[model samples]
Target: MRKAIIITLVVLISSFVMAQKPLFKVDTLSIELSDLSLHAVLTKPSNIDNPPVALIIAGSGPTDLNGNQPMMQNNSLKYLSDALVENQIATLRFDKRGIGKSVYPAFSEADLTIDRYAKDVRSIIEYLKEKQFANIYVIGHSEGSLIGLIALQDISVEGFVSVAGAGNSADVILKKQLKPKLSAEYFESVEIILDSLKNGHVVKNVPPQLNALFRASVQPYLISWFKYNPAELIKKINAPVLVVQGTKDIQVDDEEAQLLAGACNNCSLAEIENMNHILKTIEGGMQENIQSYSKPSLEINKVLVDTITAFIKNYSK
Candidate 1:
């Protein structure tokens, strides 16, 4: 009986050790914004003397803090947060106003502008400040990068990290990315739709054939997004910036990274080979690249993590 008890205790202790434990505990907070209650996830470091914090902003679509879209169920940001926490970095990630557990009163794409997201970011920054956080960083992905740039105009962040961020306007990016995948005839049609948007025309009746190409939910956000150029914004930012891009990213190309790098007075770009838009290493063709988005088994490259950690640590000093 004593042997059995010893064996059970050993197993219990081993289980505790083997279990995946978060380096930090995630705290959820609700902040009142206009007529909505915004929800944010604050990951507090386990052992630190009030370490600097970072606010993580998700990309386009209905992406949550965990980097999971409604259609794409894999949670990449969860792993990212875990990785960051392992490095003793506290992070805050949140859902957009109308998504996930966040409050929504029929919020539409028209209401989703860079300004609105900036406002939300400002609110979160204020909340962090109230918590006595001395230094705050902003890490933005894709569309969130634009929002982060806009947020800088209002809030004072210690530093900024742009992950897979575009250096051009949304319209330019859309045309460049989508045109190659579609037929030349269909591509011209897309240009016409974009031209209409550029002229500030509300598209009420998209042709039935273009339904997949032009989503109603994406239109208004696109309209609001068309007003800003990321390169221009990058130039105006006074804080030290890190531009992390993947060479294999199909959405935002190297040219975009170059444009951003050229515009920034105090910015450095780290290009990760074989890494895709979602920060997963892609080894195959187009289909394989898209498949990586849903594959959580694919881990973010170690070099990328090391680079970021080293950069942050060196810059923090």
Candidate 2:
């Protein structure tokens, strides 16, 4: 089944690879917000000074700096950072304000919104700016792609890359992913709640069974999220855009990438064959595909790394 559209309730288990005299130097960096700080892991080629850097925004959920969610320790983002650094570029992966090591004494999920997430990205960008990187790019995976689009509106970057990101708004995508499994009545409720959220309203009459997906506490976040449409937002970006999709991805389809590419100016579309949502290569049924999500030892698709490396290096300063 396709994944549902909801805040990911993730576990935090991180995995790391050890290498002596590693070509890259990894550091824990952070940026301060009003009452909290956001943390990130920066991996840069040790031999290069102020190399071009990519702010790698992870997908939704409790995903940490290593792209891991509790039981699933695939380290998807970590591998991406490793690959880029191996090719002489730097990458930074951050944990959201309340996730991973970004803890606030008064952290509240009720206070979270898509705009808030974008602001976090902006904060990280400002921090990166002071570091004197030669150039910078923003890469967002899954939900992070939309967050990147919203954040890029206020900041200028060398380029942007969207991986496994949805092309439509949260409301539209959610309705589609859920309609197949829900009963007729449940599906109707889904539509009603989504429509109300899209209109910037809170839904209080959520069915008891559907409360988990539309609980009162998360409605504000949903209200802010439903307002964004990726296709519409992509049109406003001034930087070069790369829309990446994978053939084996069960979460997002290829048409979504095409929707983004079609709307973006100075955009390039890369449809990677046999690549899954987590950016790993897969060649099997649903069971085999899902198993790959937990395999931290498995490397991500090489073409994905090469494609991004070439794209970022093309505009290297």
Top-TM-score candidate index? 2
lDDT by residue for model 2 over 105-178, one digit each (tens)?
89888888989999989988888897877599999999999999999998999999999999889888888889
Question: Once superposed on the true structure, which residue ranges of model 1 sit more than 4 Å away at CA?
Answer: 1-22, 212-218
Q: RMSD of each candidate? A: 3.6, 12.1
Give the CA lDDT, 0 to 100, for residue 104 in model 1.
88
lDDT at residue 236 of model 2 (Cα atoms) = 89
* TM-score on alpha carbons, each prediction: 0.89, 0.92
Q: C-alpha displacement of 255 in model 1, angstroms? A: 1.0
Tell me the deviation in Å of residue 103 in model 1: 3.9
